[model samples]
Target chain A: MSDFTIAQRERENVQVLELKGYLDAHTAPKLEEAFQSLLNAQRYNIIINCRDLSYISSAGLGVFMAYIEDVRKNKGDIKLSNMSAKVYNVFDLLGFPLLYEITKDEQEAFNKFAGSAR
Target chain B: MKDDVELLSTFADQATVAIENSRLIKKSIERERLVQEMTLAQEMQRKLLPQGLPAVRGVDIDAISTPAFEVGGDYYDFVELSETTIGVIVGDVSGKGIPAAFYMSEVKGIFQSLSALYASPRDFMVRANAVLSASIDKHSFVSLLYGILDVRTGRFQIARAGHCPLLHVGRSDSAYLRPDGMGLGLAEDDFFSDTIEEHTLQLAPGDACVFYTDGVTEAHRNSDEFGYERLRAAAGLADGKSAARMKEDILRAVDAFIENESPHDDMTLVVVKWLGLTA
Candidate 1:
């Protein structure tokens, strides 16, 4: 599958991974690479819009789980928005909603980011 | 003059031994390097296989997966969706080494996502087939057995994308369970949806289904493949064991049968036992 694409815009030092397609064993590596590159550059404030994501497997979920702590340690948070029902089911099953700040849309997520930063 | 000749001969013999020793040392170093490369390759291959079954209840599963040479294409894993439904996949990518290993990962991902949306094995194959054909290298394609096992019903809905025959064993006999379909990632117009077939069997107690890549059937002892007949015989005999034990036993038999012979491809095996309600 075409890996979820990542487009970046600097919002005072935040990087977002806009994920699409299926995030399973195959495409997880691409996400992992993107996260690695972001972390290497010390960009921690992360927002992942899973609007177009159709599915996510354990391996794909693992990438976020593995990096979330690092992002938080840098005084940054990882937020998710616009997750399709199928993808949300996977995250919900894994109890990820408990660990991360998930929002319904970009406005709410961006508001949370602004509120947290202050 | 006699003493001088004796000394000369002794020196010449020592020189010959010294030259041989140097050659041996060089050969030993080269051999060690080869072993090192082989081990690295094997490690890479091992990483491709899933470490363990997902923590999903209501499923009895076992696998015997071994990579040929350094890295081969065989892979198997269970993707846990919930306590009752588990998505299982076993496949072999076309080549060996890094390319096969990488593609195997891609296959795993494709199958996982397809599985998330589509419960029907045939539909899953159709979507994954289209995706893989578009993304992977044009020359690479994979033979796969993707299935969803209903733990509550003991029914396995399986779709084959040009894979080896899966066997259903019961009553001291075995039957082939394979979908007539093409491989994934091969053609632009390759119709996985139409070609995919689904077969359902209510796995009664003591009934087992054996899923494997072609490595088992194509295993060579001298020249011939261990083939489907021998595999059926092995499954029939494995009737009494648990799913995990049966998988081990079958792999052991296939391996022993092809003793002193090397398998030309990656070997993967998955055994599911329908342990119906206990008394």
Candidate 2:
């Protein structure tokens, strides 16, 4: 019933997820599944592209919280990018900017991953 | 041919009966699970509530938490720090059901234990945040607004952490009191400590303050949110009213606005009104 989707791809050895539509309680589990798969494959250097994401609730934020530790434990990072101001406000409200590396675009996030990689 | 037809009818009837039996069994199992969850949520909510708002001299206080069907983690508690001071908190944790209950209880415990140790509102938050970051999961955090109200002096010092703004209505003007702070468990000590600032309010006679979770403003009907403007207006309308009266007015407004829509999140509110020292 939730109008949400996640597109997963790998570029330059970084796992990138493209989120679309509303990411509320209904859609959080789908995001959780995506993260689970990536973790299973040991894909830690991740980028979440939120250009198409229209809304995100605390449930959606929880998905990110639930996984960040394992990703960092592997010395990998999850960087978010391409968030609209509306989407950014939700993250900012919770002080997520302090814990997550959020960039303006996917390219920027990828570049940071590249920089860290080198 | 007649005998074969009778056999087929009997077979079909048995199959239908078996299917219905299985369906009923599955439904009962699901219902059982839901009932268990609701009970746990209720217990958790009860634990979070104050046994009863104590009769603090010169102050009238009341709070409420209305859980949605799914039962979110909205928490509020009053800690009697001293004879004249009360440590109050209203907070919301992400998620619902058992997970929410666990996180809410953890936050309550952490805050409850620390309330006695720190008299300053800011110090309480800083210490609570440190403990939460270590104990709470990264995906789970609580947005808490903590205040130490000294009833004797009518001094209310408050600090926010990713919670909704506190609506304060005085004799002449009403404003939302929101000091800068992030939710607990989102950041470490240095960043959390840096971003948080404590604010103080001196309550005069006929002053009213409301602390609530997002469920109030976010309460929606047909995709239209209640919003901050409406909330401010609702509270302001009851300016100089008793704390209980203002709480009722706001609840009524929210209810009318939602209009047949069941709330999607837990709605919690705390109302405080100051009256001149009890004669």
Candidate 3:
């Protein structure tokens, strides 16, 4: 069984994906599939709630880089939220904030989507 | 006597079966040739690393790159930039085996050629990222830290491309130096250049400056990560030690943490100690 899992839910227009467990090279394809399904449905306003994310690796970040262009091209943006310090450290070190908006919590990210839509 | 005769009859039958299957012999030969080719590739990859560290005027330097059994890509190189300055770099490509090894060679060529042309660490990184972003796949990237040190003044200018931060251990205090920079190939040229940060520091005598890849902090025992705190403690143990001893200290710390676990990725470390300029 894979240690990583994604729970999908919708709150209005924003598609929230709650990521749990470890995200690494071994489980990156699972994340790729999640992003593919989201893109296929034409649902672009995305909020990735990383409250339960324990670890992340370069490959996991690659999955994000691979999909962000496509997601943005469709006029939908992916915002990240609720990352633990350890998980956030990985993003901070790699300068991920420049490409994706990271929020302190899920509500903050949801509010960002609302703000943009207005 | 009957058992011996039966055994001889079985051997004769096996010999006949072997003789009938020429394809089996040919397959075995192909497998043997493949093994030989893989060994040659491994040797060639090993030879790509620096034969030895080049001696600089007023600093002590040591480095070690240990490839895991599966050949994860970890590379380090040194270039003398001027009469008093030396350029050093450490990089790790994503993924493992043949593809990673090949990408490493590409990175090596790009860095070696570009480092001489651009003296500024920030400019070197921007050019490297521009080349890499236009060429490599979206999912593949290299994390690199390139630094140029002037031995005469003990001044170092460094830029990081999503690699581990530099570790500086003084006589009584030690910390990881964090500079703002993205990994190579992850973003376009203008965005990458705008986002990247470079820092300069003056190395004091008896200070040990360490540059390393993720393999050190990510090394684990079961599910427990070795982490940066442990890495800091390990390198701090070498505050006044030689560069070689400092390298050994960090590697030994990781080894003792992981025990006999076969590594998942290659580990690399390059240590530099400022000895002050000689009259």
Top-TM-score structure, candidate number: 3
User: What lDDT does candidate 1 reach at residue B198?
Assistant: 78
- Candidate 3 yields a Cα-based lDDT of 0.86
- Model 3 CA lDDT for position B125: 94
Q: Sum up the clashes in candidate 1.
A: 2
Candidate 2, residues A3-97, lDDT tens digits: the string is 99999998979999999988988789999999999999999999999999987878889899899989999999999999987678778867788
Report how far residue B149 has shifted in candidate 1, in Å.
1.1
Considering TM-score, which of the candidate structures 1 and 3 is the better prediction for this target?
3
Q: How accurately is candidate 3 docked according to DockQ? A: 0.56
**Error of model 3, residue B35, in angstroms:** 7.6
Looking at candidate 1, what is the lDDT of residue A78? 85
* TM-score computed on alpha carbons, candidate 3: 0.86
Off by over 4 Å in 2: A10-13, A114-118, B1-23, B188-191, B276-279
Please state the error at residue B240 of candidate 3 in Å: 3.8
The per-residue C-alpha lDDT of model 3 at residue B107 equals 91
For model 3, the TM-score of its B chain against the native B chain is 0.88
- lDDT per residue for candidate 3 within B44-105, as digits (tens), equals 77888898997987889999988876667788999998888899999888766577678889
- Residue range B1-279, candidate 2, lDDT tens digits: 999999999999999999999999999999999899788777767767777886878788888888887767889988888887887789988877788888888888888788899888888889998988888877778898888887777789999988888888887778888898888888789889998999999888768788998888778786577877888888874355777778888899999999957887789889888775744
Q: What overall lDDT, based on C-alpha atoms, would model 1 receive against the true structure?
A: 0.73
Ranking by TM-score: 3, 2, 1
**Which residue pairs does candidate 3 place in steric collision?**
none
